[model samples]
Target: FFFIMNLQQITREKHTYMLQTGDLRQELKKQEGYVEEQRESLFSRLVELEQSAADYCEQIGNFHTNCLQTVSSMKQNRESATENATKYQQTVEDLEKWLSS
Candidate 1:
């Protein structure tokens, strides 16, 4: 009878331990799922941030290109104006010389 009681006690303890282990396994699965979800969210956010950064870089490049074009056009206009002024000066000198003679 004592041996039977001892065996029953051991069986009950084993059953309780199994239940605890099952609960722990379920909890672990839930934590793993939560971690996966968080990782996916972070990955998605990173992709969006990278795309936004690329767009900003493209806009900056376009702005710089426009500024360069404007500078080039301004330089051409300055050269043309200088040439016109030189011609006008020469014409004035010729008029003065002809009038004096």
Candidate 2:
């Protein structure tokens, strides 16, 4: 009768351990799912940030190109204005000489 009691107790303990292990397995699965979701969310955010950075770099490049063109145009306009001023000075001097004569 004692041996039978011991066997029954052993079976009960085994059943309890199985139940606890099953609960732990379910908790582990839930944690793994949460971690995967977080990883996917972070990866998506990273992709968006990278795209934004690329767009900003492209805009900066375009702005730099426009600045260079504007500088070149200003230089050309300044040169033309200087040439015109010199020609006008020559014309004024010639008119003065004729009037004096």
Best TM-score among the predictions, by candidate number: 2
Instruction: Return the TM-score for each candidate structure.
Output: 0.72, 0.78
Name the regions of candidate 2 deviating beyond 4 angstroms.
1-12
lDDT per residue as tens, model 1, 33-72 = 9999999999999999999999999999999999999999
Tell me the number of clashing residue pairs for each predicted model: 0, 0
- The lowest-lDDT stretch of 10 consecutive residues in candidate 2 is 12-21
- Cα deviation at 41, candidate 1, in Å, is 0.4
Candidate 2 — which pairs collide? none
Clashes of 1: 0
Q: What is the C-alpha lDDT of each candidate?
A: 1.00, 0.99
